[model samples]
Target: MTVPSPSAQPNSLRRRLMLLAVGCTMLAMPGAFAQEVAAPATVLPANGDEIQQFCTNIADAARDQRYLLQKKDLEKLQAEVDARIAKLEERRAEYEDWLKRRNDFLKQAELGLVDIYKTMKADAAAGQLELVNPAIAAAIVMKLPPRQSSLILSEMSSDKAAVLTNIISSASDSTTSKEPS
Candidate 1:
């Protein structure tokens, strides 16, 4: 093979060196440009009105949200209050019914007591000596008025009067014994 010329070899080496340098410079330029473009030194604001409008819009949205929450809370509170009122009304009605029943029972008891008193008074007047225990005699005496006690005593038999007097005396003695001193 023929040998290449020295001048041509030198020119080819120079061209390769120039191409490598140009490629490295092209890559380095893009990196530098990217860094400069990423971080700009200046900031722009179009108008104060735009920022004010944005803030007002945000505030209005927040106020509407709060109002909705408050309304829901009020509704819940009203429902709870209504339920409590209904419960209280039901309880009141039940209490009134209970009171009425209690009154009826008391009236019946009073009527029974009156009937028993009348029977005992009639028995005492008939001189039912066999039926008159101390307890029955005492109940008969208690039912009689203070002014009527003597009449009832006169109507009763001697044995019944004696038994009642003994019971009363024993009760008095027991009460006196229970004194502190």
Candidate 2:
């Protein structure tokens, strides 16, 4: 005959457990019911050595996971820095091209302007320069030949001449070009 499974039994596990509890209560003396049942003793493992061992076993894995997360963060930051540097490099290249075009235009214009002033009479040139921007007048005077420049300065008012002289002198001064320490 084939044996039946525990679930096929006539009494279930809960029913059997309840019947056992009732039988034990009936067997006890009536005086025992009057006395309170003492609580079961509680047992605790000392110093938690098992918990410490479990933590120690997983320590290396936890540390590796932390390091992996930090590495990903650093890599992300590095990529951002690289992208910013690339943008700055592009801007610098554009700036250099613009500066070169500006300088080329200035050189061509400066040569033509100086030639026009040089051909003029010294008194007339000085009178025209007096009405121009002081910086432009000083630049033209600086570029002219020493004898021509002297003649033009002599024709100018003493105050205007002194100012031009100071500008020209300072423009050539090496100390002014040096960066402060």
Candidate 3:
């Protein structure tokens, strides 16, 4: 006839876990079961108290100076914002110029490649272009006069030729669309 331990009861683990969870939640909740305590009142200057009144006036002036300093800080912050925006715009313009120069260089290089490819045998040019970037291959084909492009495409595998044709056509369409009416 001995008393059974709590863990010996049915579903004891679940009950213990639930009790622990509830206890943790209660402890985690701020001011749970806490009593409210009143804060001590601040002493102020009494009527006709000269020294206390002077100190209060000085404090008020200091507070006003702090507010003025904050306004000055805001002005400085605005100037900094304007400076950063100017710098960002300058950087963006530089980036655009760099991109344009890079595009011009690539165009010249592509034209040179087209001349080289045109002099090669059609089958040889097609084989070399097959291993290069599809976009570059497509560009070279476009740069070649139509007769040479057709000969190169005919020499390529049908699937590769079809893909390059599609790329070239789409590129022309995009350029045409961007041009002013």
Candidate 4:
């Protein structure tokens, strides 16, 4: 098969026929032969009003996004603070409960020690108490009735009794000072 050369003749019948075929094909599928036309010249705002409006819209959108992000951050921080506060409140409540239990235990022990001293012989109790803390011995003696306290004091050496008496006096003064005015 031999390929035909392009016709140089201006009015060649074959060239006219080829041109007609191409025109028909281009018309059949307009999109395939479509040219990119320049967009219609936009009428811009001469007074800068439209430009300012567009800038304002962009700024408003940016500000809204920033505000939303900040709101989310603040909410997270608030939730964290609330969680910390809840934990602190729980710890405080636990500490208060433990303190109440400790105070109750100490009071019961003080009463039990007072009872033991009341039941014991004065001389032996005095001797035993001398071996114990002076504060504890004084507290126990103070809980006793006047006659019992006098008997226990009499059994104790004068110096020891004097020491116990000073402790009791100071303890009483401390307690009095702590009372609401």
RMSD, each candidate, Å? 24.5, 19.7, 19.3, 19.2
Kindly provide the TM-score of model 2 when superposed on the true structure, using C-alpha atoms: 0.40
Candidate 3 lDDT over residue span 98-170, tens digit each: 5565465348547579789879988999998888887788888888888888889999999999898887776
Summarize candidate 2's per-residue lDDT along 13-81 as a digit string, tens digits: 434544444344434324446666544223322335434643554566567667888999999999999
Off by over 4 Å in 2: 1-111, 177-181
Report lDDT per candidate.
0.54, 0.69, 0.69, 0.66
For each candidate in turn, the TM-score is: 0.38, 0.40, 0.38, 0.39
**Pairs that collide, model 2:** none
RMSD of candidate 2 to the true fold? Answer: 19.7
State the weakest 10-residue window (summed lDDT) of model 2.
Answer: 38-47
List, residue by residue over 97-148, the lDDT tens digit for candidate 1.
6556545533443544435555466445536533655555554455456555
Off by over 4 Å in 4: 1-41, 110-113, 118-181
Worst 10 residues of 1 by lDDT: 36-45
Candidate 1, backbone clash total? 0
Residue range 1-181, candidate 4, lDDT tens digits: 9755544443454445444444444444336457553332244333345446445535644666678889999999999999999977876676666556545534643767888788988899888878877767777787787788889899989989998898667655523332243
- Score candidate 1 by TM-score against the native: 0.38
> For all candidates, what are the clash counts?
0, 0, 0, 0
Candidate 3 versus the native: TM-score? 0.38
Question: Which regions of candidate 1 deviate over 4 angstroms?
Answer: 1-49, 112-115, 118-181
